[model samples]
Target: MASSNYEVIRLKRDLPAQGVVIHQITDDRMKTGVPLHDALDRLLEAVKGKVLLVHYAKIERDFLEAATKRFYGKSLPFLMVDTMQIERRRLERTHQSIQSNQLRLAYLCQQYQLSK
Candidate 1:
């Protein structure tokens, strides 16, 4: 891999919502930014054997597909579990009356009394 300076800001390890934020490259931060190709390569490797659980998959899939095509000359193939889709399917199976905002993450969580 090509050498580059990367600044990874990780939340506390004990936090329930652990995440890492890679700062965007600005004129001042250019020296510390990894190229898009490198970032995508790393992301692909990290998620290779994982099933992505997302609130909405379409946006994620579209962005990844575009990135993979641009960087690797191919489409990204990965499994995804969309919570919104799951709720929609469940509601359909039960023949429940669906509200306009029923499938939204916040709405579903609120309906189920789950903490955001």
Candidate 2:
């Protein structure tokens, strides 16, 4: 779902025994300011029954926590898997080096050959 203030990308795939859906929420409301609950609502609707949430960082978790407080009673239930953490694990396991002071995703992707 694409909105003027935000763009939500959803991908669904059916494995041999299970179904999975992934949601990517881009924060385009930097100036206009979209509500956290609104974004969470869209995310919840997209991954209502999926197993995992693959997000770039822990921002999604913080967003969900705030949204849950905003809604009070209604919130989605799911586990958040930070892609950053996954990459960090892979780099540590493989003993990759960080040349500079930056820990960007591009660097991690290159180290892990996860770039597309």
Candidate 3:
């Protein structure tokens, strides 16, 4: 996932045994010359044989591919999930809005009896 403020890249190694592992990248380093491929390598080393989950998979894949080509001369591993899409599917099945764009999380919590 690539965002102006933050980027998260995740990968999966095993299935039905181990859960997902996520790597989060944020802060001013995003503005510097630090290569995203290096960051992904570090993240990969941290969780080599674990399943990874991310909010958006396509964006992450694109960014990782580009970053890898620039920094490592090859593409890294490809594995991810889009939680937003999953949530949307669930919400569609339920016929209810899982979240509202007009309402903040705090406001939604108050409106929907969710804990603060």
Candidate 4:
């Protein structure tokens, strides 16, 4: 299932385990036969050997694993990079303050002037 927080999704795909994406999975799409589970299946199959990048790693890691088990009776072979966690670690190492919710994607991007 998708998160309620994101209004749209944009998935990119490469080789199996390389990378795969499914963005903008709206309700209409689900009704049109692209069930959430099916969308996730496509993602899992596509990212067979790839590292997935996300703003927060925990959500995708925890949720996708649970969903994979529930729907496929197994685990998802997921390799992920959490930019937020990386930033947090970097800040901690430098003895810098986390600054409220600066770990959020938007905030971090704004702080560093990233286009994303």
For 1-116, candidate 2 gives per-residue lDDT tens digits of 32222444232422322222222232332324445456666766766665443436467666566667668665545576676777667768789964452255666667568642
TM-score, cand. 4: 0.65
CA lDDT scores, all candidates in order: 0.70, 0.53, 0.55, 0.67
A best-first ranking of the candidates according to their TM-score comes to 4, 1, 2, 3
Candidate 3 structure quality by residue, lDDT tens digits, 1-116: 33223333332322222222222233332344344556666766755665556555777678767877777788877667665566567768889865565234344456567553
The C-alpha RMSD of each candidate to the native structure, in angstroms, is: 10.2, 12.5, 12.3, 10.3
Question: In candidate 1, residue 54 scores what lDDT?
Answer: 73
Tens-place lDDT per residue, model 4, 1-116, is 22222222222322233222233344443344544576786776666677787878878888788878988898767888789889989999999987887787778889889756
Global lDDT of model 3: 0.55
Best by TM-score: 4
Two-way TM-score contest, 1 vs 3, winner: 1
lDDT of 1 by residue, 1-116 (tens): 22222333232233222222222323434444566677777877777788877778998799789989987889979798899889989999999988999988778889899754
Candidate 3 — which pairs collide?
A: 20-51
Clashes per prediction? Answer: 0, 0, 1, 10
Q: What is the lDDT of residue 75 in candidate 4?
A: 78
- For candidate 4, what's the RMSD? 10.3
Q: Which ten residues in a row have the lowest lDDT in candidate 3?
A: 13-22
Taking all chains together, the TM-score of candidate 1 against the true structure is 0.61
**What is the full ranking by lDDT, best candidate first?**
1, 4, 3, 2
Q: Provide the TM-score for each candidate, comma-separated.
A: 0.61, 0.52, 0.51, 0.65
